[model samples]
Target: MNNKRRIDQTEIAEVSKIDTYKSIIESLLFVTGEPLSIREIGTIIRCNERETLEIVKEMEKDYKNRSRGIKLISSNKMLQLVTKPNNSEYVQRLLKTNVRQSLSQAALETLSIIAYKQPITRVAIDEIRGVKSDRAIYTLLEKSIIKECGRLEVPGRPILYSTTEEFIKYFGLDSMESIPSLEDILNNFGEMSKNLKSE
Candidate 1:
């Protein structure tokens, strides 16, 4: 009976520890309003990354199942708390400002290309679109949707571009893996174009 009592007490302690960690995580996310890497979170909580990830995943599932006003989102191993997308209208009304403006078709195409083939160069982007993408790239950069990641090693060493965290948030994606397959996108585009041509 004493051994069983000790076991129950141990279990209770473990549960209390997890609850404390969850509360700390909530506070950190709420205060920062920025994505926190799992490693960073673990460091703050004095836990290993693997354990932190499991706890965070549990929190994510709970938030999703509860349909809370705020939800947690992750991308590139970084986690952030954000207002639920469905509540955007109310948020915008409260702020008296539009959340975001629509992008141009050219900008959309450029963004798609960059999102799928990131760390890509301007020349490669132009080649794929069969047109100069300077304006579209500029627009994306200005909007903080994409940024120069690095420079290619080849001659002329053109700059490489990659989608930003803002890009992921704007698209309501949890991660880059959330992006639909390129083949699927191309197939859908092909069908649309075929229908347009037929009409």
Candidate 2:
């Protein structure tokens, strides 16, 4: 009976450790406000990939059971904590106040190009905009609306840029697909600004 009791205690301690890991991962996701790859989580938590994925899955289940405004989303094996779709209106209201800095027209133009032609290099952006866009790219990077996604497999291996999750939040978009097509924007850039402002 004493041996059985020790076994039960050991099981309980193991469960507790799993719970602690879940909480730690939850806090990290909440703080970062961006997608975290399994490798990134493993590095932060000092765990292997399998262990990190297990804890993340467990935490996802727990969040599903409990009523919470935020939930986990996975894209391309990257995990991100985001407000539930049902709570988007409320989240947008709060975000608007916090994100009051107006975007310049140059920045808007650059951002529009990126949103449509993501994974594009700086040279492509310049070609589209018909001028240098270094400052606009820098501003967007500073605002976290865009991020360096990867490097193009060409000579010089220029950095490829793409929209961040923050971009969706900023535009109150359901997803990247929600953005109007390039044709729509080309037909009427002013219309896009008006619609975004109304949102």
Candidate 3:
């Protein structure tokens, strides 16, 4: 009976540790505002992948069930916290007041291609769009919505472009997977661009 009680106490302690770790991970996600891989999070929390993933899954479930403004989103084994989509209108209003910069049609097209097919080269982007993307790429980089990931191992070692955390935040998406399809983007953003131009 004494041995059984000791085992139960040990289990309780282990559960307590997991709870503490979950809270720490929540704080990290809130502050980072970027996707963090399981490996990265494990290193920071001093836990293994299995443990970290378990905690993250539980946290995700909790956020989903609650009526919270922020939720946890995981993609490609990476995790990030973002405001819920239903709250986008309020956030966009605030952003419009503070941010005067906006993406042009060319810039949006270039960014869409990059967001959908990240780590893509500028040459490939121009080929897909059938036009020069130098100006668009430069604009996106200046806005910090896209960044150079690295050089492709092809001819001339062309630079690869990928969307940044700011892109995810600007779109109010939980993760890259949340990005709309090209058709949806065109249909929806067509209306949006008109509104922006009118304003």
Pick by TM-score: which candidate is best?
1
Q: In candidate 2, what are the lDDT values of residues 91-196, reduced to their tens digit?
A: 6687876533578888899998898788899999999989988767766776789999999998899999999999999889999889888677676988888899
The candidates, ranked best first by TM-score, are 1, 2, 3
**Clash totals for all candidate models:** 0, 0, 0
lDDT of 1 by residue, 45-139 (tens): 99998999888888887788655899987665677777877999999999787766578888899999999899899999999999988767866
lDDT of model number 2: 0.83
Evaluate model 3: give its TM-score: 0.50
Model 2 clashes, total count: 0
As a TM-score, model 1 comes out at: 0.54
Candidate number of the best lDDT: 1
Candidate 3, which segments miss by more than 4 Å at Cα? 92-199
**Looking at candidate 1, what is the lDDT of residue 20?**
93
Better of 1 and 2 by TM-score: 1
**Residue-wise C-alpha lDDT for candidate 3, range 39-150, written one tens digit per residue:** 9999999989998889888888789875788888776577777777788778889887634256789889999899889889999999999998876786677568999999
How far in Å is the alpha carbon of 164 misplaced in model 3?
15
- Candidate 3 structure lDDT: 0.84
List the global CA lDDT of all models: 0.87, 0.83, 0.84
Higher-ranked by lDDT: 1 or 2: 1
